[model samples]
Target chain A: MQAIYEYLFGAASFVPHGYCLAWRPDLIAIHALSDGVIAVSYFSIPIALILLLNKREDLAFKRTFGLFALFIFACGVTHLTGMIMLWEPYYGAQGMIKLMTALISVITAISLWPMLPKVLALPGPSQLRAMNERLADEISDKNEAQIQLHNAYSQMEAQVVARTRELQEVNQRLKEDVQRRTLLEEELREKAELLTATNAELERFAYVASHDLQEPLRKIQAFSDLLKREYENDLPEEALQYVLIMQNAAHRMNKQTKDILTLSRLSWDSIKFASVDLAEVVEEVEFDLAERIEESGGKLEIGDLPLVPGDRTQIRLLMQNLLVNAFKYRAADSTPEVKVNATLHERGAPGTGGAYVELTIQDNGIGFNQEDAERIFSIFQRLHGRSEFDGTGIGLAICKKIVENHNGAIEAVSSRGEGAIFKIQLPTSQPTRRNNDAGRNEAI
Target chain B: MQGVTKRFKVLMVDDDPEDGVLVQKAIASAGHKVDFQVVTNGAEVLDYLFTEGRFTDQSRAPRPNLILLDLNMPGVDGFTVLKQIKSNMDLRRIPVVVLTTSEAETDIVKSYDIGANTFITKPTSFADMIEVMKSLKKYWFDSAQLPVA
Candidate 1:
């Protein structure tokens, strides 16, 4: 468009000075081409502007189309005035037409600058739609990110509150535990004091009982001996019977006193544990009871024995007592047989260390009923009459006491007329000082 | 009980009078004459031995060659008296024998540790007491040599 403006101005400058320049053939031919172009522009540009105005409701197009219409009208005026200059060639007609042409060209050229920028800068609908979609996606993405950040912040706050609550609960529990422990310690001290007083009382009572009973027993025995020495032949059978009965009663009382003493002594005895060789202990027990075993025709068989921590004297007493019971209660018509076997057992609740040694002493004797199993270990608790079985009923009780003192367990599984099996499980290690290794747990 | 004692004095520390009479009879029946002096508690024994309080005259309270100590007594037990006697250089030479019903290991060990010459668990029957007295007499008076006090 600028190139066309430059071409028109160059042709207008060629007219001779003060002559009828508009009448020149070159100017006339240029004017004719300019007139035709302006007419075509007047029709075509308005039609194009109206089409645009019809498609869009933007009011900016109305002003733009108005200015373009004015450009076409001015060009038409310039072409008509040029024809007037050509017919009136002499006088100031030529200068006046040239100045008017220059002025109209300059105005048209300035107006067209704004139109070209508007036309080139306008975008297609597809491009505009794509840009709108991109802006919408960016806003939604930012909203999603903000929502995620808010959720994460709330989660962190909840975690902090929960952690603080847990800490407070733990602290409260610890305080309660300390209070309970103090109360327990006070209770334990009181119990210890009471036990001391009770022990002293028991000691005094035992002393008085033994002394008073023995003093009367001494007089009776002395008088009886004197009677037997002085009037044995003269005394009647009934009198002698009376003396014997008296003597038996005295002996029984004496035995009862000794048993009571033994029972009391068991509590005061010191516990001494060591690595006891079970195999040797069994052999010695069997050999010691050889005479009774042989008399009962009992076959005593022992399996492999494992070493365990225990008091040797107590263990020996325990084994001796069990063996004696087995031989004494043998089946009437059958030869008694006893089997002693030992095996390593996994540590249970009452047991400690890596493993425990369970020594099972099974006897093929006349076993008591299952109901009598627990009763058999009670002191002086007899299942049969004295004539049926000769026992102080203390042996099994002593064995049970000894096993318990060693921190072990003993149980008897038996059925009437079958056999009794006494199972003893002892840990390989002795019980250690509980608080010495504070952080360590017992090896299970 | 008075007639049973003729020669050697027997000091009996017992709370019950019946028990004291029984011991006097048992000692007498053992075919030995003893001068019986009965005291209810361990304090009386100490008084009689040291000639203090009720027994102020040293000549009437004869020093015994053998002392029969009971393990349990009211107000200062036999063990405490035994400990006092053993710890005293002048009194340690006297033969102190423990005759008590309690055969508890603690009592036995403590009695022995306190320098008791012999420990005898009291029998429940009278006949056994006679035998215990006889043994006590034979072992303490004859077998064991007495140190002149």
Candidate 2:
């Protein structure tokens, strides 16, 4: 131990390094300058490494860099020992510094060589430039894709707006159509109400004509008859004739009033609809007027008849009036002959509705003038006096009313001394909600 | 009416005075020996039937075996009076015959619907009126087994 300590600090027994240069002043001076320069260069490199390590602590092989700095510092110390030995005979310290430099160099090489592949595995400048170019291209591609996505989003929003606008327009059209339909329905309801009012008025008039007005006529006829019967022997012949004439007039007036009432009672409101076979109705009417028809020497020629939508009683009344008219208006020379037939008529006009059943009643009777054809359907439109044919001139009028009540049309064509042809068109099927109003027809 | 001795009481309702007089005369000649009474309005009919007001006396308001009702009147019409009489337990048994000058179908149907035993359209002729009265007496007083009043 004493020897090793003497060797490590053996400067007391060693000569100065200037003796190895044989005491040549110029050589020693040159060696000292060279070592001084090398020492300063080595120390400056270590300081630069330390400064780089302090600033870039994240550099790879940081411990290896510290080892490299220690190696360089040891080399700098050896160079300084060389420079110091030339002046201060510190050969032991110079050799120890050289040994430390060698040891530090060995450690730096051991650490640095193990990490050589890792340090070289880092990207070179050209590879980093290529990666930067590739990342730039990818960024541009992403930017383009984002632009396309934005355009698609905008387009989708625009389509939604257009669709919303179209739907709004359709909704508006539907709203307008609904409003128009509501208005049309309201108008139809108002017209129906007006028709009901007119029917009520007609029923009231018929009631007054049938009941109140007939009472006075009845009383007139009754009182006059009683006076004539009770005072026949006491009264004068002319006075009795006057009473008889008055009674006859009253009776005629009463018949006229009753016919008017009948015609007016065929109001549109009091219609009860049923599927009535016209043939059956005609048979019933014929049965009712059998005596009259036989007395007039009239014959009925009934053809195939169809079932019509109508009130049975009203249709019977129609057939009866028409048949009576035929039998009553017969020629004085020739007997009456009546033909009744019905035909199916399809595709009627809009005013007449869908389909129709056309009935024709032809009669060989004494006919009226052409101008009176239309007027025959009017009330109290008699062609002859009451004595000629005992009628109140309301038969045709009542028939027309029956036909009109059944949503039908009636017309007559005739000539003087010729037969008459009556055409009646009726709807095949009646509307279900027909004439539902209960009219105010009261006995006065 | 052929062999029975008890006289049948008949109540006639009429608005017209002449018509009432004619009915009374016709009933007199009907030969049924009917105790006939006449009232001008439907109120008097109820009054007489219920024996109220002036007809509170039993002698004045004798219950009739038959009631001849006039349909049309100025106040308390025949329909209202008939409804009351038919609904009443005491007066419902009496056979009510509705007679009216107005021979409308509505009046006839309403009369029958209101429980009239017979609906008679008043005849215009006096002879026809006499015939109606005779037939009414024969049907009500003789033929029909009416509830005793």
Candidate 3:
């Protein structure tokens, strides 16, 4: 133990290394000064490595760099020992530092070999610059696309209105014919098909709306279109006029069939009750009518509405009908504005009735006589000549049926010039829902 | 149109001859030179597509790029025809457009559920019909998407 201690720390019994240059002052000074400069420079390299490691905690080879710093610092101390050995010859400590530096250098070298691929994999500056450029280009392209879409939509809207007006006014004589006297024998036809589709008790109307009568009318319109396209220049003017009338009448009848089909489908299918959000329903209706509203230059104001237990589809139809009627009957000079507002009212008779929602749809348009309010909802009832406004006249009637399906009541009041107001009251929840059987699937 | 070399083939299944003529005229006026063929009933359509029963002659029954279907027919209805065509591996790629007078939502939903590519209500006016069919021309000319073998 004594010998080992001596081997590691003893500095006695040895001459100073200054003897190598024969104690020349100039040579001694040069060796000490050179060692001093080399030690300081070595120490500075490790300090710089340590500073770099501190700044870049995310560096891939952090431990290896730390090991390099330790070894480089050991090298600096070894060089300092070299400067000191000139006088004191601390050979044992010098040997110890050199041995530690060798161990650290070997470990750092081993660590670096394994990390070569990882260090190389790090993204270079030019690659990072390209990625940044690509990301910036994508953002700008997406922004440009959105702007172009917005522009195209408004342009298309303008084109649609202009083209439709031109099509309706294609023939001066046809325009006069469209305005002629009144609707066809719609009342008589309605007495049969109208009651058939709405009255679930009537089975024959279901067959009629789905087949036979509609097919012939559809064919007539199709062939008339074909004739007009093929023989517009060849046919006599009178023949072409007859063809136009046939096309017009057939088209109106087909629309009536569609309305009847809608009613019949309601009668055929069972209503599915759900948590119907009236505000959302009104928003959807507004979206569907957005184009029409734009063409009419109209506005719709919707208010907060309570959720009711009813069919969402039926509610949508009811709102659509009223809103369409409002737009269709707008005063030629005025911009139409329709407002939908609702309130949740307290239950009636306490235990006897559940809560109900009362809704009011009001419009600014050409209104009808108060006396005809009741008649307007009847099937096939039209308040104006087809010339003034073209409609199947079944819109209000469908609205009435939808209201009825929800176990509700709908009524309208209007003066000749004052716009109409439709008041609706429906139970907040269906009473039959408590049985749970209705909630479960059952065919109508 | 720049690279096209042959006329696009469209097969229409309709019972009404007038409707057939109307669609043919509409396609012709759209400036898409079409090899328009019409079959009057559902049975003929099945035969025309599968080359079975009356259309055994392969040369007479060339595969169409598109099919225009009408739901109402005398024998096997359009729904059956659509189901058969969509289920067959050989015929499933041809796009089917349901051209019908039925505005019933059930028909629309059922046609889509059965794999009809498009559903359109039969138009009432020549101008509107042209407008309705403009997209059909667009679809026909989209050669990259065409399943033509």
Candidate 4:
């Protein structure tokens, strides 16, 4: 049975049914190879399209390019499988046909390898055009947004300009207001100065007028008193007593007027500075008041005094007045020990740069009440009666003025019937002090 | 007046004309024949001395031997005038006595500093003024040497 079948099929089964189908095996092999080639080509085209679509990322291209190359080689394998299957059967009978089929299939598959990458380079034209249109729309939208922002910037610029103009106007108004205020202040200051000057002039005129008036009044009082003294019996006693009272009042007025004139003169003259020796001045004062000092039994001890810069004669007057007061009001039976001492007090104060020479005149005299200490320096202020202590009542006031003229201060510390210490602090060579040095001895 | 050095010429510089008249009377009362030249203020004193303004007749307005300077004169007080006269080399030779109402010690010292021959407080009593005038005659004419022009 096997022999009969072999004769009828003419070795078709043994050689391969694919070979019998071909009058030429090469043609048959060509046909079989074409099937695998077409399939692999179609498959490779899809793979290349996927690779191209995913080629944007560097990592995607690295992974996908290798797969694409492998796909091409896989296509080559389909043709290789057909050629190998036909090779074993036709190795002796039709070797050229097998070899030729394999060679042609391989050449076609290999040729498709590079062409697949070129065919799938980018997307189709319609899809790319659609993407470009979408991108153009997005850019146009951005441009519209920029135009809106530019309009907003212009509006903000207008607002800023308006704000700047408002601020400038405000500044101008403020400057004008300041100028007006300054002018007003200047006018006010000038008016104040004029008022002060006018007041001073009026006071001076009044003083002079009253002082001159007193001279004529004095002659009247003197003549009237002379008439009363000369013709006492010729006039009534009541009339004589009235005339005496009138004379006394006139004398009091004269004294008051003289004191006022003296005070006015002191204020009118400006103070000046010069080298003044207090020791010499005190010695002269002692000589002048020798009788009073001797009669009162007051011991005047003037110690070493520093020479300072001041009005010399004024300081002399100051010393004279203070000494007179001490002698005039001595403690009963106390021997009236008046010690005049001066020492440069080294305060070493900040900003004062050292010492202040203070002339202290302390006296064991019949001191006044504590209340009178401050009041005694005032003009026409007296603690005692004219009968008890004869004075113009302006002595201490004049003393204060003289001391003040020397840029010095006089203060009295006293207790009733105990004693009194008058401290006179005068600034030394203020010329040597720096600009900022307000004298330490300026404290009154 | 005959025995005394040929009736001394006197110049009184005062702000008040009435005061000037009073000074003239006072100078005349001493029995000395004093040709007293009166100027209203310190300005007139300068005008008379320097022969400026109204006082152009230099020879007619003879230079006075004594100047009785009242300190409170207007338009240039006696102090200012005194300072100018005492400092001037041409005029400093003349003796100046400061006659003013102020008895301030400072004024007294200042007058001496500015070359004033003497500083005398104005006495309220005319009798005291006469005494001052007598002393002035004794000191300037009898005691001190009088400068001859």
Best candidate according to TM-score: 2
Query: How well does candidate 4 match the true structure in TM-score terms?
Result: 0.58
C-alpha lDDT of residue A289 in model 3: 96
Interface quality of candidate 3 as DockQ = 0.34
State how far residue B97 of model 3 sits from its true place (Å).
Answer: 2.4
Candidate 3 deviant stretches above 4 angstroms: A1-207, A235-239, A287-299, A330-337, A349-352, A364-366, A369-371, A431-444, B1-6
Can you write out model 1's per-residue Cα lDDT over A1-444, one digit (the tens) per residue?
666444544344454321445356787667656656665665566567667777877756576566555555555555554544444332243344556656766776776687887867776587778877887788788888888888888888898899899989999999999999999999998898787768756755664575456556655655565566457799998998898788766666655655554444444455666778888998999999999888877799989998877778778878888877877887678898899999886757254545678889998888989998898888889888877876677777778877876778889999988989999877777753221112122332
* RMSD score of candidate 4 (Å): 11.3
For model 4, how does the per-residue alpha-carbon lDDT over B1-149 read when each residue is reduced to its tens digit? 32264667778787766556545555555555666777878887888888888879887667778888988766899888998898788788888888776666778888898888888876554445556777887787667786675
By DockQ, is 1 or 4 better?
1
- The number of the candidate with the highest DockQ is 2
Model 4 lDDT per residue over A1-444, tens place: 765544443334455535556547677767667856765775677477566666646443443444445555555555555454453342332344445545655665676676677658766688788878888888898888888888889989999999999999999999999999999999999997787677567657656865676656655564564466458899998999888887777767777777667565555554456677888999999999998789877689889977887666567878888888887786456788888999786664224545666788888888978888889999778888877877778878887876665556788999989889898777665543121112123332
Candidates' interface RMSDs, in order?
4.7, 1.5, 1.8, 5.6
C-alpha RMSD of candidate 3: 37.2
TM-score winner, 3 or 4: 3
Ranking of all predicted structures according to lDDT, beginning with the best and ending with the worst: 2, 3, 1, 4
Candidate order (TM-score): 2, 1, 3, 4
Task: Please compute the TM-score of chain B alone for each predicted structure, in the order given.
Answer: 0.90, 0.94, 0.93, 0.90
Q: Give me the displacement of residue A381 in model 1, in angstroms.
A: 4.4
Stronger candidate by TM-score (2 vs 3): 2
True contacts kept of each: 0.25, 0.50, 0.60, 0.00
